[model samples]
Target: MGGSDSRCLRCGSTKSREVRIFDDPQSLSEAVAASNMPKEIADELEKRISSYNLRLQKPHSAESHSSQHVAAMMDATGDDGQLTLSSLSRSLERMDIHGTTAEKLIGQAEFEGRLIREGQDTWSWLQQSS
Candidate 1:
């Protein structure tokens, strides 16, 4: 409702400002599609919605979300991405993922070359995977 510099609350950006859709998902998706929003914002909304749907449909599918979270963490960790088991455990806990899931996800990431073991309870991101 401000001037040309009005910020979008969802994305905190000034470009492609629009209203939030609170109706059914089908209608909301259609509104998003027809809006003048940026592609990145649209894609992010889609991803978040998809992730939420997946979590609702399959509670045990948290592993998939964990992988995505791990990748995001790696991105934020920079080139020499290094992490400890305790740190990873705490991160997963913050995401509401507990128990052996964190350890399992780290093992899977290492197996997929997304991460590499550096030492006991320590790991590093594999830049080649990015």
Candidate 2:
């Protein structure tokens, strides 16, 4: 597998990095026991039972994430602001939220109306539940 760098894959500007990796078997088991992670995750862990080197990827996903940046930006918008999904997706990418968690995050964020997608390279605001 290839590694992602610290720079934006699309733009050359420096990214505000936020994600981290944790893959220890014991820790993984503990986290699994604690959270409401979906069924596929539990099933995926079966592979780790046989393999010792299965590196765990991003822990928290976008759906589970609420941006301090967006929160602050939207503070003035109150209950009616808008945060686009693409920008939130980009923020999630910056936060290193990936894989299944990322999908869940997108789903949850949309469910909460925190983001709205308009067009390519376009987004207006991010609404945090008031």
Best by lDDT: 1
RMSD of 1: 17.9
- Please write out the lDDT profile of model 2 over residues 17-61, one tens digit for every residue: 665456788886777584666778777886675464433322243
- In terms of lDDT, model 1 sits at 0.70
Which residue runs of candidate 2 sit more than 4 Å off their true CA positions? 1-80, 101-103, 110-130
Q: Against the unseen true structure, what C-alpha lDDT does each candidate score? A: 0.70, 0.51
Best by TM-score: 1
Candidate 1's displacement at residue 47, Å, is: 30
The reply for model 1, stretches above 4 Å from the true place, is 1-68, 71-80, 98-100
Clashing pairs in 1: none
Please give, for residues 43-125, the per-residue lDDT of candidate 1 as tens digits. 99889999998879785567576566665455434345677767766666666654456577678878888778888877887
